[model samples]
Target chain A: MKLVPTIRYNVQDIITKTIPVYYGVFTLIFLTLFSMSKLTSLYMAGSFSGASFNSTVLIVVIGFVYTRSSFRYLTQMGVSKRTQITGKVISILLISAVAVVMDRLLELFAEFLFKSTEMTYEGSGIAFSLFDAYLSKLGPVAREMTLIGLGYTSRVMLLSATVFIAMLYVRMNTAAKVIVSVGIPVLAFVGMPALAMLIPEQMAKLIHTIAEITGLSNGLPIRSILWMTGGTVIFMMLYSLITRRAPIKD
Target chain B: MSSLELIGISKSFGNVKALDDINLTFEEGKIYGLLGRNGAGKTTMLKIIYEMLFPNSGAVHMDGHAIGGNDTALGKMFFIGEKNYFPEEMKVEKAFRLMNDFRKDFDPAYANRLADAFGLNIKKKIKSLSTGYASIFKNILALASNAPFILLDEPVLGLDANHRDMFYKFMIEKYSESPFTAIISTHLIEEVADVVEHVVIIRNGCIIRDEPRESLLDSGYSVSGKADTVRAFVSGREVLGTDALGGFETAYVLGECPKNDLPEGLEISRMDLQRLFIQLTNS
Candidate 1:
């Protein structure tokens, strides 16, 4: 069957209204990160440890804003439920990809302006580490592309969870929309680690063993990635099912 | 096969009954006006016919097949309500694109022609348009969709007289080119009387009067004269409604009034749709 025009229109709507807003926010985030990196260098010399905090804050902010805008557009368009959800998924992926690329570019600019040193390349740069890992698993070109693709997908899924949670309370009102937009990401950011700590010692040991097999570790970044991905996926799946059957008054 | 049919349909909201034991049928190539007062269950009936709301009991059928949620039968039907349901941020062109996608028979050229006719700006967002323009754009979409069965609920609510006339003219023009079934639910009976063939009057959640407009007009009569004279003439007759001014009284009575027996200065005229609707609904 041919794709419904509503889907195409909704996608176009996402590109027109949602993307620009997100790009604007992303620019602000990149600038903020750049400044923070500089400040960290000035204070601690070689120890710039607030990178994770900056990245998390930026991702959550962008994700929440985009999700709220997307939901409003989808509902107002009178798009069917399936198209709304699917269009949102596609939109999230697109925005997330742009955000990831912007983040990397900002990192590169920081490295160049602050370090100001040229060195012989043994492998890809620090920003390319994720891409290199994916390359090692897949191949040279495919792996690099796949890593970008995966990063985009991961970001989209995580943001979709925020969209879904926000939707539960704000499906009908703008005030609720704002509340959920800010609430879900903050909860996910702060709540996941606390929940992880609640795991029993034996279960933690078992999880650690499994993490080793999967090349995961107790490293804060890896643990945070796992938490974000797992939580977002579960939340998104549940959200999708709920929204699929949600009653639409208009 | 019938173009549309509703069998034993019933619906309720909370404790209030919106529709009760309703059945309706429509053939192809005919225009029907669903006439009713506000809250007379006209919208509810239309919603059920379009499968937007499922009946608490019974079923709707199209072409001898039962209709359900997401039914293809709905593809053959276009339903426009009083509200502007299009995305607020959507441009007129984008709305057209959506119509073209969901409705297989949508005519883009016709839509554009109607847009030009109505002076609607294609680049304007739906929310930015005036209420009249919004109604015009929606009417254009309904016309362009080209669904076999078009159901309009107060489709001209926000339109000015000029646009309303333009809408009826366009409808007639389109109907002449390709005859299709339409059921317009509106309170503006007099305005649509010239084009509408059949009228279905609803009252208290039921079809009270469903007949050809011509037949209804032919069968009803209005008598106006001196109060005593009109009263004498209408005594024991089926008087639908009556109005009095000073000593003179005007009475709308169903069935023919004998010309020979009328008083000399008394006036006897055939009832029109507006009178008929007022008589039917108010009584």
Candidate 2:
């Protein structure tokens, strides 16, 4: 529908602005890590480390920037807020997919240049630094790409949606904005820990339930992806609510 | 010939009412002058029509469909707003490329021609342009858009007299070749005095005056004479304001001239758009 053009415009805008910042931050961190690794390897034998950026930072940055100015630009172009919300989420999905690929390439390059990084497993059987771990077990190539892409996409979109909503929530003058801003820190700093202490093994039980539902220990990413997809939809609905009558700031 | 109607439109920010119960219709192909003083809800009205700011109540319609969420309908009108909404780093020509993506009827050749006329360098980034050139850049976009409706808010914000004259002439030329509804909001009332066919003046969040240029001009007449004679002549009529000095006074009267023999030393003159605006909007 109208989302097609909006997506094209937003994706272009997001990538044009986002990529440069992403690469700039990544290069600074990577080169600093490389120099540190070089200096450390000289003194300490068997000390090895290679750095690659967590593309989530880029997604978060782009999300903040979109709310900061890009939405104003698109809205000026006659884009509806609904279309903008949808377009931005889709843009994040595309950016995340592309960023994941680029990130993996850079990780591989970093590993090649700096040190060795093998896909290792913890005792719980969760794979980290994934490399060819699921090629034989995860069915066809397309399905694997879908699983991986959707996983990256959902994570990135979650951050993008959260950051966007948080930025926009500040724009509201409602009491709810004040409540959310005040309540979250209280919950994190004082309430959660107290709740955890009051209920025996409460935090452990919660994490265990989440793990079981995600099939994390069972090594099935589909359940986690389905949950992430559900989360993404919920965030989109929230975005639609906040932005239905959102005013472009002066 | 797209018709735009704002029925009972109202907007506010916090406790301040920006526009209140405003209704207006922009018929096709006629230029309108939207005149208001600073913070008189002029920009707010324009922003509301463009859906940049949602109204607290009422609706905006173009040919009967709600324009708030309709991009295709919204696309039919291009607004040359006061502020820079485009990304700061984008070059002037790149902005045209972006505009091309949104507005289908944007004439790149015509835009380039206008840019050339203004001696604007298309390669310069928008942020690097001076205020006058920035205004020129936006004006070029709006003129070349060929949209059925074009809203210009302070379109000649920083242009010199020569450039402003050139803009007015070219605006008329563009309208002549391909007609469209243009609503220009500005403080420089006298500049667009003859260029616009209709006048809409807002004051303190209300539409105080909305009428045709000729009728509005004819609605008021200023009389200057001896202070006593002026006061006597304006005794029965609605006098907007009066200026008095050493046995002489000038009284601005509203609602048509009295058809009577003028007393000695009493004279009447037509009220220009600017004077009419000043009289009507004086608060």
Candidate 1 residue lDDT tens string, A100-163: 6654554454455446322211212332443344346566576555545445545666676667
Every candidate's lDDT: 0.69, 0.78
* Distance from true location, Cα of A154 in model 1, Å: 5.5
Clashing residue pairs, backbone N/CA/C < 3 A, model 2: none
lDDT of 2 by residue, B100-166 (tens): 8777799999999999999999999999999999999999999999999999999999999999999
Number of backbone collisions per candidate: 0, 0
Against the true structure, whose TM-score is highest? Answer: 2
In order, the candidates keep a fraction of the true contacts of: 0.11, 0.53
Ten consecutive residues with minimal summed lDDT in candidate 2 chain B?
B255-264
Note the chain A TM-score of all models in turn. 0.55, 0.73
Q: DockQ score of candidate 2?
A: 0.53
> Model 2 - which docking category?
medium
